[model samples]
Target chain A: MSLILARIDDRLIHGQVTVGWSRILQPDQIVLCNDTIAADPWQSKIYKSAVPPDIDVSILNKESAAVFLNNLPLECKTILLVENPEDMFDLVRRGVKIDEVNAGGMHHSNSKYEMFEYVYVNRTDIAYLRRILNSGIPVNAQSVPGVKIHTIDKLALDAIESIMP
Target chain B: MINGLVVTHGELGVELVSVVEMIMGPVSGLTGRSNSGKSVSELADEIKELISSDNDCDTILFIDDFGGSCANAAQLAGAAGSSTRILTGVNLAMLLDFVTWRETMPIDELPRRLVEKGRQAITSMGPVQEG
Candidate 1:
């Protein structure tokens, strides 16, 4: 199938995805779906440099991304990258047939707590992730290929209790 | 915070950490050791002391080169505690990656992931990366 993996990573395309995941998934193309980057030409070029010469890179907004993904050749092996959980949520809401998303590299920030060394989230971030999970979409959290998969159990429970007294 | 030790020939390891600290702020859970004046056994003992004392978190030992005395000493020290992992050819990016990622990875897997992260950071300069 053309769509080998759909991934949501905060850092977008960097070393871990290019060298690490690409070695395992072997995608011929990488689609980065972000509204701001699509509108900005220079930012798009910067992301392009990070990708290998052999692989193709597409930076597009969600609406355009839906169209671009729909039109890709059936034989084309592609891995779609999005920076935010909401963007992935938006893609599926627009009817992109992404069944699952490999969640990776949510780097720590002051407002965020470290779930793992590479994965970070705030209370609000967990809620957004739950939205995807509740919609029957699987969010597998793991940084490198073949490493242990991080469960959303703690985040999910926090999301549930967040609404309660 | 996990523990880290950067081992290098002469004072390179010590100086690299100083540069890294300048760039990334004061890094916790990391130390730098140089084999400049110390014997292999002395260096190995220093590593073992740190590894044994850090009872809370896992430790990663970074070496500047492989097949050298520094690497040998690190490997010998790593044997005493399975918590210690030695990665050869440690660069600036690799050290940054190790400190950032040690929390997410088990001691057994941190070195592999850090190596990959370091490899990704290295590339021939291009205009697209310019500010």
Candidate 2:
């Protein structure tokens, strides 16, 4: 398994992920682990085409991805993509030894607590990822490359709590 | 005429414009959102107006994403004719070459340009395979 980078982003795949992230990491294979995207072929095609043509992309569900991660091929650098904490938790439960987890594009939304001006992590997501961190996985938040790192624990819980209704 | 439209969601369009201009010289189009930011649908309608206002013979609108509001709006606004192409995933290289070369070549040659420019932007950075 050439899985070097693992990221959790609700957008799954978009401009920031494809254009910005792809240029930095140059990951040959981008695997998006989301049940919804895997089930919908058309959605998969749309995301697949968004990525630079040279890079291969797979939209896999939780179970299949668990198996894929276990027996990852020894080849080019691969990036494991996920939409939320639940997916990450699922992988952890299935024994995906991801040392680091990146949080990207978790924009402001209803029911989400504001951790930063542009970032809002839901309580459930925070708790779940915290568990992963407590279990020994390091969860870091850097919207894009070359920005100051936002450690999951150091994330502004006060700011988030203030935004909660 | 191999015309193209660049529809940006946020300030990202500004960067796209620079990239496109670097490759294509000067061009005209719409950037989909205002600072206050209305819905993607609203932005699409405005872009539709911009394209329709030009009345160009052959146009290709490059939406940021196939699933984005601008791209969807382009589809909804109905630029489905053969002469008009709706492309998703607009990149700096694609915009630059497509716009710059379209002036010298016929619209029929656009497909080749898109492929060439797209391929040029890709650089393999990981482990190489042994044959």
Candidate 3:
């Protein structure tokens, strides 16, 4: 199955993902893989409510997602939604092919370093993305499609290290 | 061309204006005034001056809270003779509605339309209860 897109957005299934990115990607199903959401049925149900009527939504954890992605047919068009860079790398290490990564939205925690507007990253967070980028998989930071896509290159990653631990 | 003015206790007016602009593009004929250090009378006078100055279009005042200082001031500021009216609980959705329908909709019906917009925007997104 063709993995149409893999997006790392904390707000897994919101307007930006539902309306904004879905308009561009138009995948058959949106598989939101998050540890917390997978465990909490209430959270999963809430997230699923945001999905469009025509499309499918799957809320799975990292292991289940890897298994599902591995088993899909070559023609299956699915969009993988990961909450953080760590989970993204988990899928990558599990032999999932990710052509590109889109960083949609990451609000600030107490210790987060604000990389861009509405995007925050910690030391470990940026490190994970940097690892993926070093492997030649480019991470493009764009909250919504049709907006200016900022390539998460060496310069952008280096800037975050200065402000945060 | 109805001129819209937002008056709030603090930065809600400014924040709401920013949200409206962020969703829509750069807009004109709309302004936001925050009551940081001004008293109720001073705020009322400030809004009154703005309402008086712009006689070209019907000015609509959108305040933060109902039955509060901001709302009372806005009500006092808007002229009774002219077509100046005040709308309370001015959220982004309401402002967007006003921005979209300001040209076509008359000043008399704009409040009801905007109030409906604000009401419709708030949804209990959880599972619906079957009757």
TM-score of 3: 0.61
- Predicted structure 2, TM vs. truth: 0.57
Q: List the residue pairs that clash in candidate 1.
A: A117-B104
| Candidate 3 C-alpha lDDT tens digits along A42-117 | 7787788778788899999999999988887787778889989999988888877888988877788988888888
RMSD of 1: 9.6
Runs off by more than 4 Å, candidate 2? A154-165, B1-131
In candidate 1, stretches whose alpha carbon ends up further than 4 angstroms from where it belongs are A153-165, B1-131
lDDT pick, better of 1 and 2: 1
Model 3's CAPRI class?
A: incorrect
lDDT of 2 by residue, A1-165 (tens): 477778888777765566556655778888899998899877787777667778888889999998988888777778888888778888988998787888765777778876654467777877787677777888788766655678766355545655667
Q: Which candidate is the best by DockQ?
A: 1
Better of 1 and 2 by TM-score: 1
Question: Which 10-residue window of candidate 3 chain A scores lowest in summed lDDT?
Answer: A15-24
Model 2 RMSD in angstroms: 12.4
- Weakest ten-residue segment in model 1 chain B by summed lDDT: B18-27
Which candidate number maximizes lDDT? 3
